[model samples]
Target chain A: MKKLDEITKRMPPEFNDFYRQRIDFIKASIKNYFPDQIDKDFLDRVVGQPSLFEPDLKATYDTIFLPTQEYLGRGGKVLRPVLVAMCLEAYGADIRDFEPVFGAIEVMEDSSIMMDDYIDNSLTRRGGPCGHIAHGYALANVSSCTAFALSHYLFYNNELKLPDDKALKLLDYMAWEHIQMAFGQIEELYWTQSNVNDITVDQYLQETIARCAFLTFRGPMRYAGILADAPPQDIAVLEKIGEYLLVGYHLKGDNLDMSPDSPEWGKVAGEDITTGRRTLLINYLLDKADKQERATIESIISSRTEDEEKKKVVYELVLKYDIFAQTRDLAAEYNQLAKQEIEKLSVSDEYKLLLNQFADYATRRRSL
Target chain B: MLHHLIENFDTEFLEAFEADQRTINECFEAEYKKLSDTEHLEQNVIDEPLLAWDYRAIEPGLLELMDPFMESESHTPLLFFSILRDLGLDPKPYVKASLLLEYSYFALGVIDYFDFHKVFTERKQDLLTYSELTQVRYAAQYLIQYPRYLVIKNSFELSKAQNIALHKLYATIGVTTGIGRGAFLKWGHDYFVSLIREHYFQNSIYTLNNYFLFPAMLGAIIADLSDAQKDSLQKGFSALTMFAKLRLEKRYYENQDEFKITPPIYRDLWQLLSFPGMALMENGLQVDPAPYAEDKYPWFTGLYRDLNTQIQGIDMADTIKTMEKLETELFETFVSELGRVDLLPATVERLRNCYRM
Candidate 1:
């Protein structure tokens, strides 16, 4: 795990540049769009307490907002959204006007991560208490709501300035994204409660691909493609790039399941076990092992012991089958595929640089 | 948008409302006379302390947009009318309220989902202007704020009127029964109890909770404490705890798949985690038969009272006589609609289930 530190440290710099390039332009565009500030006081009056309308404002407005803004304001990886901006930048389209597009998307991604961590019940992210743990459930719940509101508000605000047809389409796209995410959550919840054979590893992988990763992953590429007004074939390729990144992100959870450096998900470790949440790791181990070993794993999993040593031993047994290496190989394969797609594009020199940079940065980052 | 709203509300009911305003006015005046006699009745006053729920303002712009509707009731009392106007629909206050009741009974929680909400929701496209959302938002806000409005309206109406016909109206209907004039105390008890039962139901849960809990908690808090201190914070705490317990109980049934795995009670589960709101209603009255009959009525016909002229125990022997000439007419209007409440009919079997063994 210590040996991996160098890779993690080096990984974020390119992402930082990626996001900075985005926010700088976003700040300007949003300013141009709304010359005056939105009057936070008015928003506060409408929001009231943290009801469904004002979820995150109710939850993490006090707790996570300050820190999250700082974290975001300071240098960090803007890998996903930057890819989107870069992809658009690569295409022969001018997108300096669409800054809120990036800010709103970043907000959505942050919410997804915050919520995912809570669901995973893993503690810590970027080396701090998980949002749920620090802010409390109400706050965490609100944090998600805030992101949702921002998305809707952004769509609403944008709708006013854009053509009515395009505004509706934008809303429709958002609704589609929400439904997909919700469907994915239902699948995960079902797997968590029911038997393994009832669940499919491929389905889990696919959900991660389409829902979690695709929204942000392909968002950049598609955004870039659309902004640059690229060919449909290029858009299709960008979608695949998103699918690749999603699968790679799920591998980050492999550390939570099979690896020894257990903080892999921080505080939320053992959440899946506590929740009986099935993942590919458990599915593979069950498939590879005999009935008795499967039963052994089931029993230990059911107990949900917090004992690190005991869980570690079980994790080690699963690891012996070379699961992590297998997962990594799959990741590498996707990376190659993504590269092939990038190669076909007659993108600008700047886009080519961004594509290569994101590919390397994604390949290096360990956790989802 | 306002024109569109007016079109949806153009029903035979409005014509009758127009034709019968004088009759309705007379009916209310007659009832007001009797209510004046019973004005000092012992039951309506709350001995227990109370406080307002959170002093939340309606979204500022929305409230200003809705203020005109709240002023529409020069003929009928403003208690129920403001609810409609306060909400952004065309300002037929009672008509809108009655319509809201239709949705309130069964479509409440289901409406929270975007699709179901379309019944209550203006299409996002339809709501092109910011003022449109403000209007829709306030109209909904009026419903959400129904209790406070009801309290204000009821107290004002009751103080002026002498007829108890309005009292009878509340005893029979679910819509106007909540926060009606003080004579509807019996009706209120029944209404709240039925609400307690239905509040566990998904379709009714959120609306009932939002409608009923907001006021009950507000009243419980306001009755005891002042605006400045709200010293009845403990009662507020109790009310909140009670609400949460009911919420968890509802959730237990709501998530049936997960419910199967969950223990029947949230007590142990909550205690382990120290849920902030447990044992909320421990101090309140623990009456048998769940306190009030689950099947609420707009009128409480007395079970017993000896008539001066009757020999055999007259059913109406013990009945409390109507005090106003117009009371009879007001009571008639309420009865006419009893059979038409199509949402979920109060069947004999349902009533039995709500009753004691």
Candidate 2:
């Protein structure tokens, strides 16, 4: 599998430098935020009773918690929490005070992935067996709920020592984000389950904005503004920027999923098509393809086969239609809009530069 | 029935209650008329269906929407009105809020129908047209946005804090009912795996709790109860949800697979017993021989036999009698625990009757 650095190396030197610095910052922050060792004592105390399962039930707890631990270790961009910390830093808030918020967001993201992998029946994630596959769906489901509960605990415990009102506000925001993400997820599920053929780009965009964009962009950015005690207008602006960034980020994700360079992507490529996910790429192809082409694509999607041969056929069509480039352009367009939104923000230049660089990387990142 | 529910209230309260009901009816009528007036606007649209936006056009079509897809029921209005009346709040804004909730529910139903039809059911022609699909998609978007719109619309009446809380609660309702419940059903259908009887039964109960029972309890607290009283009753409400789950499970056992799967109302009972776990018990007793029984957990073997025999021979009327007895005991316990708080006696009575009815 290609290292993320290899992908970053492909970008211009300045952009690569910015990206590397951002990654290093995130890695260092996470190291500081989490305990150096998740030893038995730490797990028992922090993860609480789940770690102290009775002898017979120890395996069950391991089944659930170990996969979460494994998946967290096999980290991706750590984008959401890093965004939270960056925004807080930009606002000159005590970034360390908001460690719980960062942890909560990262746990929430990982939990969503666990549940998503289960729901999508994904066999592999980050070049390893998905949580549900390594464990079982039942344990994976339980772990997802546990992660949500832990996020709730982070807020309720108010380890940041925020005022009551501020803590409540943060809790309210997290709840709202969770509900919105669920709504978005349900829409995607509904679309895939229905396997509706007449899907329009508008519908695809709506689902993407809800499922991918809101949590990734709007929610994290808004949370940052809230913690900073920024005015409502500023938070609103942050939300707008986050929305554009989210759309672009989601498009990049879809492009990677369909890319033939599977090992480099570090995920099971073509899982979207094989699982019949309603992607921007699929919607675009449906809109552009001729009748015979449309039928062929539809047949492949509906077949839901994991065969390499069928996946090859679909990938060939994606290439033939230049769907990857088209999607990439759409992402770049959103990234541009995001940059424009950043310019409208009244934040310091440092914050602006950091956000712009992040947006640039999001629109360009080649690997998962 | 409305009068009976609130007969103990003062004349002023009764009049206000009646007026709120009237207002709710009038608002629904106006909304429906607006929907009708714009029906023509959707007729010739070439875009993919924005069914979510043009909800009224799909309102009537809900009756024809098949099983496993939610349909708006008469109980929703009753539930809303009852909660408002019991709380003694000025129902005007809240009634309007309920309409937003109802519309979201309706939109979810329409989306579910489209999804379910696409996934199952071989009738190709009955699938939503492009225009109808657009309507449903738009309706879903509307559903997601309803809480925000409700806050904006009612911000003047509701405090900032109250608005935030209400928005969170309403969003909870939408997610819990639409996605949490809907996804479970879709997953079961897609996998062709037999539903776990426990999950199937408990999920149905939880669905009712989230959609109907919890909202009513939360509404009363928001509208009427003091902060301390609200805290006290929250525990009771949680208890009642558990009771309701047990009640629903007993109901399913009593009914067996006697109910129809279509029309959605009786579908839970049918679906709950459709899992592979229940397959052995579906026919007359046909237990695996001792060798197979030895490999299985001893307790499960015993429990399965007991369930099969009980389900096979149980009298519906007797089972209902037993279930009602158990429910009454649970309700009494809830009322007693809740009575420790300083809520009005009438309010306590209202809580009891709300669930009983």
Candidate 3:
């Protein structure tokens, strides 16, 4: 229920400093890894072209490619790709050499967002019309597939000069992550669609870990491991850390969504409630509410509307139950676990400190 | 007593099988607990109460069907564990492999519940309520997507190539036995009635090949053959298929009157038949025999009598006796081909226990 400014005022100076530095580093890395001019030219030349098979259908290219570029330009945190670069650097890989790989991760993330927004029937993403809304559904669908092809092409034609085996391994890891994420997506679809009320906290954990955590956290970290040829044992540790960190991150996102005054959060607040997404916050509230309160929440969810009044009613119930605090506690627990796992890594102290700080910022950041 | 079939069936394999079964059961128990936890269930309440069944309610009919396999304390994992052990491959990696297979099956069961309900009957409206149907618009989508996740996740143990091959084998079985057969029954149920009424054995046999024999071959491949021996096991699989077909035809004959005369009998018939009878239908046969009445349909009684005559002519008692003998030969042939002479009798006995006919 707290506004972003209020939450920011409550944060310690050191935490703010760490968060600001990370964001700055991420922005600079995006610029360095993918220059603006080259990206535009690449988009124009590759994505902007007419269909190879249907040369006359220039509209297909314009509708699919232009909107994709517009969507990419709308910009996100680029968190996953940043994670890749951080992990690569921590593992002592030359980060500059893996620019294409970083770009591929960003491309994959953007494409997934395009598809997800379409699937969720979301109208706006990052303050702009969703891809399917900007273009048409048919063109958006084609662009989604095109994004994947572009990602694969980036890896296949590795400009990083990775050894043949390492290049293959990188591709394999990317493909594997993509598959795992899709499974998670399917599970999400099942839960949301089925109106399944019996979803437990554990089920929520499993689904989120599969759906969001794998791609957002684990995939990037593991890619870095593969690039650096880190030990399999260390890779395993990274996976656990990724899992915990991502879960915490999702919990925080869920919290931010329920906070009505956080317009800086972008998109829509209470969208999860309106859409009936089975977030940890929703699950927790359902678990804790008494029968009468439970009925009230169920009624709101069943209505499945985005009415401001309905969102306010649900927000009141969430507050009465103290669900936000409980969710934050849970997120803190995971963040702590992630930090513990980070400590187990054989990486340098500086890398460890950076990871711990990032985990803190990831789980606690209130605004850009 | 089951141990007597394999010549050198050691106690370790049994212990290993028991341990793997326990692990898998524990996994399911954990899942079930999450589903059944009142607090969690109460918390998970959505607008659609039925969606809650995703976690909480187990469809009694599906549970009863799955009970034997669930109670048997193993499914594909047990088979994989036993086969991998016999083949001298390390069985450790297969624990995860088996778990993945079980999860895939669990997800498939969820899809099957929706399928049987015809939830997607009105696609546009249903999509509004249950968007998950989009992922599995074609049943083959589940086969392609879910199994690949298992292989990818478990690819740490085997090479990517090996994992793909093994996963493909399982996926193929799912498509052939689950989707392919389910579609056949759904589409051909009316035709099958006409075939039964007219006593069209040749046409029936052709239908049976798709509805029955192919699935039987697939089951045989899963049961008796490894990836390396896929090509070599064709003859063995064919023999097994023939035996399964005859056995099923005999069972159908014995149950023909019940199948034709009583709708409830037909409803229960597939479930009532032991493993061998169901194998013939690829475990997907669901018939409502009510429509094929003698008065309503001209070919009904004649077809019934002809099926009866065919049933009477083949002494199932003798055929089963012959099948038992033939299975022993097939088992021996498979073992010899694998060059695992020591495992021959035990493997055959295991097959015998599994194949009720």
Candidate 4:
């Protein structure tokens, strides 16, 4: 909640001095951002309507509503919306014009989450039973359906006040994003199920970039450009910046699954193995492995292992290739590209500062 | 718990409904004596006026004890509940319970400590509280027809009076937390909502609404909560579904169960029927549907079985049309039970009448 200039001052002094003028650029754009649009009226409507458990009220309470209510009241950082708001500011947007778009993004992100948890079969979330875990399979289905339908209401009903063109464009963009996401998920599932090792590192990286990083960073950046109807050259530059930053995210995102407790993740001075999935690390290792070692790696992975220790040996064998340093250097190269993309933008000096700050945050975010 | 059978309705024939109230009370008195004998349990009971419900509820620290008890595998060898069930204390005679937050544990005041689970408690406490206590009652609710979740779901067609009578059956599910205990005691604050939304909700509303709703009470049972929390919670209807599934689960252990992803679809087809509120069960609790769905529905059932068997190894979309035909047939079957005669025109008329009325 600190003023933009104040927060800019807190950044690395050089970075702050370089980006300080963007305080106005960001401040004007974020003056109207809303994290979530939930209101008392919405809550009341939720109560008044019969739950999927309506007639059987008390039993339903034990089985359905209480579980879901507990989850919502106890939940997350609402980070995706924050990502969207940042992109709007980078484009020098007026916060008033961007509020509806941000709210829509939150609902979209949350609804997708409802579906995501089901896909992952993850048990606990936000310190409570997931909607499905608490609601039972049938009713959990009911809750997801309702959540999906509710998410579209804000935009479709003209309730959020987006302009007709922007609203329609958002619908188009979201639909396309959903298709790419589903496509990426299907690819992942098919690969996992087939137990096939024929997939290339490029395909794996592309799917990860499209699914994990682009939508998180690019979609909102694109949204900001489109809202301002920036010239095509500027839009292209903005997208370039987004793509560069996303590459870094994809390189790091693979290890997100490897817990600190995991023995598979041992100390690696320079060389890192493919974290998991057939990343560039494992692919490089495969290229380097003697035929016997390659065959051995193929046999155990294609089949099942007895435990985590066995899995760690497989991971360790791949680390021998030093593909870890390869990806690390590659990620750094993308970070430089991100810097280059920001410098190419011809926006005013004030706008340039915001762009610089965005580039810095996107690259150094998790590193610091 | 609150003499519900008396205050809520005419239970002058207590001897008839509660054939063993004396034995139930006696069992509880002995249990109380045993609890009093245990130095740890002796401090839990607090004496307060019965009508001062709120005071009586929290005064027991019953919740602190119960919190450890809630996750005690959700079932336990608890005496009061067994006595109540043994005495046939059930919903058909009406039971009501409510959960309220207790004395403020936080000075910040936003967080309700009563609503939160007790994570610090040992697994042994979970053994005593959740797994042992609620699971037993939950198991019984699935196993015993008298206190089952299905019977509660079936109360909709009951007369206004009978509806009230059936509300008490929920008390068994409520018996544990009376104020919810260790609801998710050990569930830490790291997992994300993305995880909750994507992975947890496996079934869609369309599936439940299409297949499970109306005929089954599962939807209504979950819809029973206040509106504020609907978006995130996940619920299942195993309290009824599991009654049958438990038997199936047991058979699995014995290696006698049909091991397949496709559950026996015919159980609902043949057995789903009215609760004892309309028809008495002489021996068992499988709902009998001969009256509502009728013998004619069985031909469609056979067709379904034949279609499933036929389509097992065949192409997926090749069976889509057959599935579509079956879906239509099922729709007709639903309409037929609603007393609609004929198909297209009559179905339209029926829909119109239902919507208009």
Candidate 5:
């Protein structure tokens, strides 16, 4: 079977600048809003008066935003906001008008990633030390809250002057989606920590729609579609694309995490096995493993074993079953569905091509 | 006088308060059960006995999730109702909001379980039992979002301004909790200054302000008070909250035995102060630096004086007098409308000792 890296597609040169500009725009937006040092003016804006007397402003910034600042500095794809910008362009709106929305989406994504790392006790994120490891766990914990709040603040205080009804709808949508996201995470935790042992690929996909797809895919597209006043049908199309693309994107991530050179891409290879986390590959393996094999896999996962040899054993078993190839094919099917959804949109071919390129970059890219 | 007020709970008033507590607990359990049902959380899984379920292996019960909020000896809900009564407002419509406030407290408690445990064992090799830490930590990730969900879900019952205010209120609660906790972990050698700074900034004042201001802020929003009146209300409550928080801190430090069953952070603070920090501000704690520490390092001396000046400037006698004045001018007439003078002293004490108070 072909390995993941051998089939992995690189971001096209034309699309490289497209992605870079969005990342830069998001980084600039963040810096513009959260000043170098937090002060009364910023505090008054984010959290209104009456201000505290003699607040340790420096301490507040250091404790709250500094870790986030450093983490955002490490730079992921910033694709959620990019997706938002894409939806806006397709709907004939200027992205510049919604800069705060961009900041909100990116910051919320960062906050979730930070919290994920903290919960998983991950050692690294974006190729460096995790926020909790780089900063103290205390700063990381509180910073997550601060960053989450800052995202809402950015959204509410957006300068776009959106109509009240639309604003309210968008706010409610974000909240409901977040609740769905939370439940998805909790359910996944249940499966990870429990002996239920019956999570099918279908069940995992449903969970992924909530856990991975909503925030990463549906949210950005829907935010732009709603803000751009796109018709409900178009919004539905974009949502479908998001759902399919995110499943493909996530399964691709699952496959990549097991690939031998995943470390070159700045993530620990076979980390899913080491952490005993549930993944598409592991689900397939469990379905196929006999009684003894199932017990070994279950024990390794349940114990969250740190032993190198045991992790190697799981890795060998994964190869024995050709699980990575099977998961990769599963991911490709979703990616194809995403492209088909992209084709259904009434936007210009330029927008479609951009989106198709994005899908490729999202699900097929070798690096983070 | 404080003990007299606290110990002598009026029997009729006690009955009324207990009735309120019962009503609130019923609402919490019902809502929680509904939420679990909506989420399809297995009932049998949550109902299994604690010993039978491994903290690491099994998902915690929805019943356990509600336990820290419902079963706590907190008087926040009752005092909130009393304060609403004292303001001449109908408290019935806002019961759900008060319920959300209790859940908000529960959410914070979830975070605090992790925060305090982390701080309590910052330097220890075995920080916490791995399972317990993961369970609580992951619980907080979702639970922290619960109150905000309740607010957004119940938006029809609230005005736009009220909805916005409540959202900001939750965010501020989170930010303040983080700031206060982060301060403790990164507390510098200028310990008192750090502690006092954090307290005023967002630690105690902002944290405790959210609770006192929860009801009052709602009152102001519902009353359509001008921004100035809202600011005035906040200012008044700020001073009161400061005094109340100081009293609570003193009580916390004094009650070392209470630390036995609680998270180790409290005991660790006591040990750290009693040993290396070289100061034990024990009973008869007057918030005076001289009574606690006698360090003569020049920098330390300056910060010590600053801490002393800050504490000394807060004359509790004057605070009490001001509070009495507000009771008469601001609250007495409205409270009289309830025609329950027998409930007054207990209400006053309970209000003083709200969620954090």
Candidate 6:
């Protein structure tokens, strides 16, 4: 696994500098926005009564606040927030003006991940116990519920005090995106729970778009466009760009799941297989493998085999079928398409170049 | 004679009210059929393992459970349609929108029930397996959003502004329910205060207002109702919602087994009921259970009278007396407020029946 610095070093110097500046600000801003602990006075205001017993504070911290920080502190790529700012910049809006809403993206992502991890029964995330495992299901679940509610604070309590019409539109957009996300999760859960293997590439792609793409790129990008009041045509272009980038980004992450050093980068090698996730790679392999090979792959995926030897066999099949190389090409193809979409945008050359660089970084990044 | 309460009212009013019920029930049946169809995924089978427990295999049974459970909460959807019809607007277009609202609220209710019972009671274990609990939750998440897709797909009839209102309505409900659920699970003075501030003071009110007002807002915009008319309708529906929630909670409080109520839980409930109005001022929050609340907020006074009654478990005849008095007073206030509005006679009767007055 590459160090964070090494990953940045691989990016073009200009984009690297741009990414670092905004990424640092996003990280710091998220840190500043989430309170470390709930003080007694803060509790009093929320509870509405004068007398708050001491135990409530401890319970609140244990159930909601602490578990939330533990999960958020594990560090994500902050890709969504960065994309939000970049989209704002493309529209020639001052990203600083919308700083508060950035945490909205982060908390929403954190909240979704915590819930998703629980649903999937994942053991590890970002090289630590999944929230549900680290903090019992009750605490993890309640904390996630809190995070979901608090995600709205960034928009509702924005320092700018957006006009009612605009504010309503933004909130509406977010809700619609969230509803789409739930549909996405339903399909993914159903596919795995049903142990369904013959998932067509289109079926797989649509699920990925709904589950990962919308929240990760499309939603945040459109959110920025709406906030900037970008032209509808440009916003449409941004949406396509986000969709393409997500396809590329998601495929690359799938390939990384089998990398030997995935654990070093806070991923479990073959975790998708064990969880029976119908990734594009798995679907592609299932489609192409011979009768015996298909049977073997099916057996492994359906059983959620934990045997290293069995996982290695699936990895060998991946190589024999050249699935990784095919995935890389597909990812590259999508990344190029994303870059092409960016060219259609009316944004300035610098912003276009930045968007294109990030497009490359979508597939080029070493770690998931 | 009591059952014929609406027979003496205008025929058009009765027809509209019945039509709303029929449409809501139709929507529920449609959603139920779609969810219970077991062959949803036929050709996409991974070689069936020798033994595998599938969540989908039990979906039919779950829907069977969900069907009756949803029917029991039918009043909420009725209230929505009643609000629209009472305001003299067509409730047809927003029937699906009301379905979206219904599923959203019910989904959150299921989550609250599961999460709270998982901690507080072992009784749910008899009713649902761990897998059933989780799978039901996943199904709920799907149920909540499927109607929104229907709304969007059928968007030709809706204006962009109306669509935005629907979105805001769903989002506010989701956020507020999350706050309410979190607050319900955590027991502490601070947690209670936070719950009061976030859930009651802000989120819950926003949610209830949205639920009651979305139809009115859409109807007003469509009918070109004057602002004064809109304001009057809004006040009536909001008041009705407030009273309904208070009544619902009062019933829940009535069912409270004192043996199950621990020290902290008991104390928290007590403080919430007896919280001094001035304490809110000290905390920079004003207590406003107004318009319906005359001297003291009905929430405090209504619950305070029966504070000891809960712990006494109705064993003492005095306990039941206090409880009945509070119930009668709350019902009278609700009926009085209903009278203040310009609702059709049938709409008012439906609400009385729906709220079990």
Better of 1 and 3 by TM-score: 3
The A-chain TM-scores of all the candidates are 0.78, 0.87, 0.84, 0.67, 0.91, 0.90
Colliding residue pairs in candidate 6: A46-B193, A46-B194, A47-B192, A47-B193, A47-B194, A48-B193
Per-residue lDDT, model 2, residue A31, is 51
Better candidate by TM-score, 1 or 5: 5
lDDT string for model 5 (A88-137, tens) is 97889988888777777777887777777765666687778877677645
* Cα lDDT tens digits for candidate 5, B26-120: 76666666555533322311222211222222235233443543344334566566666656667666666665566555555655555534342
Better of 5 and 6 by DockQ: 5
Tens digits of per-residue lDDT for model 3, B72-179: 221545545555555555555444445445544444343333333233222223324434433342121222343343344443455543443343344333322232
Give the CA lDDT, 0 to 100, for residue B212 in model 6. Answer: 49
All models, RMSD in angstroms: 21.7, 9.0, 14.9, 24.9, 8.1, 10.2
Which stretches in model 5 have alpha-carbon errors above 4 Å? Answer: A1-9, A20-23, A260-264, B1-19, B39-70, B86-88, B118-128, B147-149, B188-202, B222-225, B250-357
- The count of residue-pair clashes in candidate 1 stands at 44
C-alpha local distance difference test of each model: 0.39, 0.55, 0.51, 0.36, 0.59, 0.59
Candidate 2: residue A38 Cα off by (Å): 16
Per-candidate TM-score against the hidden true structure:
0.49, 0.65, 0.52, 0.44, 0.79, 0.71
For model 1 chain A, give the 10-residue run with minimal summed lDDT.
A49-58
Q: Model 3 - which docking category?
A: incorrect
Error of 5 at B331 (Å): 14
Each candidate's DockQ: 0.02, 0.05, 0.03, 0.02, 0.22, 0.12
Worst 10 residues of 6 chain B by lDDT: B41-50
Residue B200 alpha-carbon offset, candidate 2, angstroms: 14
